[model samples]
Target: MRQRNFRVRSTVVAAVMVFSTVALAQPAAPLPATGNLQPETRAAQALPSLAPLVESVKSAVVNVEVVAKVSSSRGGMGDSPLDRFFGGGRGGSRENVRQGAGSGFIVDPKGLVLTNNHVVEDAVSISVKLDDGRSFPAEILGRDPLTDVAVIKLKGKVEGLPVVGLGDSDAVKVGDWVLAIGNPFGLASSVSLGILSAKARNIEAGPYDDFLQTDAAINPGNSGGPLFNMKGEVIGINTAIVGGGTGIGFSVPSNLVKALVPMLEKEGAVTRGYLGIQIQDLTADLGKALNLPVTEGAIINDVTSGSPSAKAGLKLDDVVVAIDGQKVGSANALTRVVALKRPGTVSTLTLYRNGNKQDLKVTLGTRPDIEGIGKRTPRETEESSKARVGVSLSDLDARTAQQAGFTRNEGGALITDVVPGSPAERADLAPGMLVVEANRKPIRSAEELAAAIKATPSGGTLLLRVLAPGANSRFLRALKVP
Candidate 1:
């Protein structure tokens, strides 16, 4: 019996060896290389006539021409239709004319195009011209003024349309090769190539702004055009030009579009979560006072009453380290993360409180239409102006603050106003909130505040003991009086 078992085992081992030999002889083909150099070599070997991805995406680019019909109290002077008929007609009348030209690109085969909001703002008529010399009347899908992004749709039958692919803008590093495709000075199909000069640049174009700085020769007509990477993926939307800088331009990153496009397509506008908390970057002095390990994250300067932050128990001087899983490296990063989230969405905010990490759940609310909410009253303005600081001030008033979706009642003198190109604006004194004190002194009237400010010597450091009702309540801040 033992001899029979040994023969069977030997026979089984021999069969396995034969199978293994066959498997080794028939090896599978090697995986295609993902490296660009190897791929290029293979492509050259396969077909040397093939062009780069830019050639494929070029056909999708288009020119946008917008015409706005404006009705004004001040109308065209002389030769007015009313004046020619009645000989005493008023000059004020409504007239219509073409505004300007910009660039856009088709993102979908169904004729959906993306452009800048300011490009087609208030336009009664919008025409899109394709590279193939076809013209179509386009309708606006949505316009987000804050981000300056607009989506438009072509009405007629559009066929054989090429679409531009969106690339991850976050993946693009400085000094990466990029291409700008747009119509400058009505010149169609113009392309310029350059390197990405910078990324995550704050240009102060709007409240939620992080521009992609490039030296790709973008001009006036390049607004809303595509800024493509070497791989032919659209990484950004060309937006603005820098002052006195040759070949220096800016583009809105594609990540913004990834967040906004779906909302615009479905709802015609983007909705963002609002907390109404003013934040400031942590300074060296602030870090020292807070005893922080590092000067990172957003420090809550003030929280609006009844705001999402206040309801979430966010305290004054609490350093926000992360929001909804994304790290808040700066105030701008936090703002961008919040702006991407929809109102009514609950987000987990990680905060550093007394040198401890804690996460709080904050349900966001709808943001207010700040443009519609007018400035504060004369009395409110007069009172805030009295705050003896270097800044001009005004109040957010009970009504204005409420309408603006503020839930705090500790409202005092809101910095309703700031002079342009002034020290106040530069110091980031915005148009909202309550000011409780000036130069560490409690201020009951705007007159007293103004007196304190006037008494303060120029270039002196001033301390303010403030009561910010929301996230930052009873906070002490110091500012340099320029």
Candidate 2:
């Protein structure tokens, strides 16, 4: 049995040796010295091109021209019908017309175009020039400056228009190849390529400041242009470019644009939900001090009296962990989630108060129209005067005292309102806060508080003791009174 097994093993080894020699004796194929052109190499050498994508969607991009009237010392030959008929061509009274340009894309087949609000803002006449050199009078339907988005429509008959496809901005990620198509410097149909640099960027444009950052050569005339992904889908609207900075451009994510467009279309305006609460992020230090298990939540600093949050029993120092079970990790997150909710929607807010999780149902209220937003926003201008403390104080009447959760004997002025840009607002003196004392003196009325502020020594800090309605409410804050 041993001899038979050895014979079988030796035959197998001989066959392997014979095969190895034959393979070694075979001559190698003579090819270029570089390397083998394998299947994968050929496939990899094929670079992705944007030719087809650009060609497919280029026609949908339209050039927006806005003719606005400007003041001039001498009137030019150009005159409006109102100016010509009214004989208002005085040298100083004459107005000059200037044209501004931007870009947009056709969203609907019936000739609805979407662009940035600033493009056609305050224009006396608006026109959209298509790729085929067809110019049509355009009417501004609505605009939302908070997001810098606007929806315009083609007036008169419009048909057979090519529309650009909208992509999911949420699915877009950093390093994804994108193309920005716009009219840079009024040169129409210019295309630039770059990767998405970042997402959810806050440039302090407005309350809803989340934007998508890209390096796609966006410029002044590129505002309202389309930022297309490799799939030829519009994922962002190229909006602003950083001055003196290369490759830093911003775009409004299409998801947010899509959400706001419907409201802009229906009501020609955008309305947000207001919770009426001053909130801050639960930072690491705040979490530690509050004995929170996780540092991801929004902490309520002050709840507005007579507001939805105040009516819903939301209190100071309560950490909002989730909205409708969706986790909230920051103040911005909570603000966005609540703002996106429609008014009259009862949202289940899960809160963490003193290490105990509690659920509160909050009915959202309509956000008031802010001063410098929406289609009816006023033209840009410098603020002429700064507020003293940014707070509007009122004598504590019985109703006001009750609203502030204080008795008539509290001996303080009730803060009825807080100006957006004020020293008091900066010091976190919001509405419904009782100014118990100013300059270490008991504040009995608005006049007393004003006198205390007037007597503040130059460069001296105005010490104030503000009382809120809660367990951990009484606190002293200092504001620099110059």
Candidate models: Cα lDDT each: 0.70, 0.74
Off by over 4 Å in 1: 1-51, 71-96, 373-482
User: Residue 319 of model 1: what lDDT?
Assistant: 92
Model 1 lDDT tens row, 180-238 = 99877577788888899998888776778888989888765677899998788999988
lDDT for position 237 in model 2: 88
Candidate 2 structure quality by residue, lDDT tens digits, 3-94: 00111110101111233334576888876543668778767667666799899999999998765444445553212322221122336753
Query: Whole-model lDDT for model 2 versus the true structure?
Result: 0.74
TM-score of every candidate: 0.63, 0.64
The TM-score obtained by model 1 is 0.63
